[model samples]
Target: MYVLKHGIKRNPEKRWALPDRIFFGYGACAILAGAFLEHPSLEGFYGERIIPGEGFSGNHIYATNGVIAFDYHGYSAREQLLEHHKRGWASRNPGWHCTIATVDFDLLDTVELNRRKMLGPDQYLHDPVPRARRFLRRIDHAEGAARALRTVTRSQPMLRVACTSDPT
Candidate 1:
């Protein structure tokens, strides 16, 4: 029975920033999804995720472009994403059943914007557009790093094979 906390206030003049792990969950998903919409291939969804047997439920906003789904967990195949959640939760709670119902992206975005306006001027929460952009940049940078690592690792086996095959 998770619920959104409202009326949290912050100093209007103070500079506010999102935590490093902001991509992990909650409203941050919404912001990230919104930002991801900039990519024409992606569509954002507001998902109401619930595990009825375990009495656990939450909202998980994410972006998917037919083939890939992206969220706090990063990129996954569109088909495997929800299944992955189910497996993870089921492991913790025997007989766990999870389901996600999607709502319109616009509706969720509007609601989030309204809620932020109600909350005082905490720059991190008050204005999501720029925050989302910054978050997207971080994601891109991380993806680049991961790709580079994978490339290096893949070449290692080849390098070892070449060294072993050579005779002095």
Candidate 2:
């Protein structure tokens, strides 16, 4: 489940509006890649994610480890993620194609650094790392709480009562 801990801060009147919107994806991709890549089992990718029939495409980033992929949507099977995009785009634009062409993860750092240089002064893009970390912390805390609840539930014994028919 993807929890949107923050909302988009949009200001159409600002001169940087367009660029800020574009770089927001890049910043998010980089931040998620960085956060997930902190785990040794994951690998990160950065590139263009395309929805061919809809004629939509954009620079994207994600982390995966063969079975699962993580991005702004949180953890999901790669196929599930693709299917989600396909369904979403088809619903809006009537298309059934979705694919990703990834580049090296090393470029993410450079991309993020340049994104920072370009949009760092803007309030929307400032302190991306801290924001990402905070998001991670929230997820971790939630997961931990869930696990603790499950443990407590499991540890408790179930109650049972024998039913007897009354004889008159």
Candidate 3:
């Protein structure tokens, strides 16, 4: 069984939303970043893996099912994840088969999946440049990431629910 973790961060006006499609399929272990699953048939084949880097920094433990189109806020991360998958996993897996969904936390919130629990949420909506820089600085840097992860677990919501991976 894959230990799956997925959620999005939402602060007042903005949210760091990850497309549902990113989680779909058997995710590979790219970095020592987190746990990943393997396909039964394709034993050696691992899915696309992109570690949080310079301009991007949102770490999520993936396993899943489903697809969705991109909107403005989620476009960058979505594009990066998709492009990697297209070049790697798609060619290897042929018919990529899997399904992924997020647990509904706040009915009022727009993003279905709340990832604040894992990578923490992005609070700088208005200041995009600062947010991007911070994401790179903190998430990419070892010392900064350790400090940030501590904050994420400490500030997590009271009641956190988890969902299983549905490898459709």
Candidate 4:
């Protein structure tokens, strides 16, 4: 506590000093300020590969907050969805130490190949009449992806259908 020293035997050198608690508060504030000033590491992070004009899987896989992530796109119209490994995955993800890594990129590459195959021999490139086989292939594939992903997520009860006849 500090008070006006009017008629007390006080030295003139250290007469006007802040309280001890106030000095300590300033010290703590300085330390917190330094911690946040440091930047996060972005040196070895791998770039994501996604192309435009490619096909969409249309299956929602993950969700966070109010955002939902559907199936990943295989190809892009502008550039390749996945590029060649100029550098290894080790360089990209330094702490990526997985013992049971079983995914093969070769199988994943089939997405673009399958899409083209479903469209048939490109017989009528100019003539847009009767492209039923190709049309059916894409439709069936999209439906299958949706159905498979739906198995993982449990749906909420129908809120608007409460008035329906079937109560079961």
Alpha carbon lDDT at 80, candidate 1: 55
In model 3, what are the clashing residue pairs, if there are any?
A: 7-114, 7-115, 8-114, 8-115, 64-99, 64-100, 65-99, 65-100, 66-99
Q: Give the per-residue lDDT of model 2 (tens digit) for 1-168.
A: 221223323442332233422333433565545654555233332232331433453324555543345566555555555555555545655434444554333423645436533223223435455555555555553353344345435644532211111221
lDDT score for residue 124 of model 2: 42
lDDT of 2 at 118: 25
TM-scores, one per candidate: 0.50, 0.50, 0.21, 0.15
Pairwise TM-score winner, candidates 1 and 4: 1
Q: Which sections of candidate 3 miss by over 4 Å?
A: 1-76, 103-168
> Across residues 62-144, which tens digit of lDDT does each residue of candidate 4 receive?
11111111112211111111111111222443432222111122211235324423211122122211222222233343354
lDDT of each: 0.45, 0.43, 0.28, 0.22
lDDT of 1: 0.45
How are the candidates ranked when ordered by TM-score, highest leading?
Answer: 1, 2, 3, 4
**Candidate 3, residues 1-168: lDDT per residue as tens digits?**
222343223332313232222222222111111121222111221222223323333223322221211111121222233444434533444444322233223311224213322321222234233333332233323343244335445644422212224333
Candidate 1 Cα outliers beyond 4 Å, as residue runs = 1-18, 22-24, 38-54, 107-126, 141-168
Clashing pairs in 2: none
Order of quality (lDDT): 1, 2, 3, 4
State the TM-score for model 2. Answer: 0.50
RMSD of 3: 18.6
Task: Say which prediction, candidate 2 or candidate 3, comes out ahead on TM-score.
Answer: 2
> Residues 1-168, candidate 1, lDDT per residue (tens digit)?
122234322332222343533433544555566566655232332232222343643335566543346666566554455555655555666666644444243423555545533221133435655665666666663463355345445544322110011111
